[model samples]
Target: MDARVDDKVVLVTGASRGIGEAVAAEFLASGARGVVITSRKANNVEAAAERLGEPDRVLALAARSDSVDDAD
Candidate 1:
């Protein structure tokens, strides 16, 4: 898997689990610069980021699909 996704910044909504979480991990493995993972619960998001083993490379945000603000 030689994808050239290095230095890319990605924002992954609903990334606390399932498909979104998989996508985030893929991007990180591809050498993405940063990944902002958001979910409805802060703990869930933090947990997801921790799973990636690079907390410094992830920004865990508490958010829901109904919200309309870029918590960045």
Candidate 2:
């Protein structure tokens, strides 16, 4: 672990699982101030967030990357 993210906010897309989830976890492990995870499936991202096990430090949002509305 390093101070690379000491107090920085991180946004990880497609984070419901796979590489995105791993990245989000790493950010937390590396000491990020907070992490915002997004995915097309609401349930999936929410579960992924919970799995990260840092409720206070993680925010999960269901958003389709290709959707203009979701982007907003």
Clash number for candidate 1 = 0
Across residues 1-72, which tens digit of lDDT does each residue of candidate 1 receive? Answer: 376779988898999999999989999999999999999999998999899788878898997766667884
- TM-scores, all candidates, are 0.81, 0.86
Deviation from native of the Cα of residue 41 in model 1, angstroms: 0.8
Q: What would the per-residue lDDT of candidate 2 be over residues 1-72, giving only the tens digit for each residue?
A: 454997999999999999999999999999999999999999999999999999999999998775467556
Q: What clash count goes with each model? A: 0, 0
- Please give the lDDT score for candidate 2: 0.93
The segments of candidate 2 whose C-alpha lies over 4 angstroms from its true place after superposition are: 1-3, 67-72
Q: Give candidate 1 regions above 4 Å deviation.
A: 1-4, 66-72
Worst 10 residues of 1 by lDDT: 63-72
| Alpha-carbon deviation at 15 in model 1, angstroms | 0.3
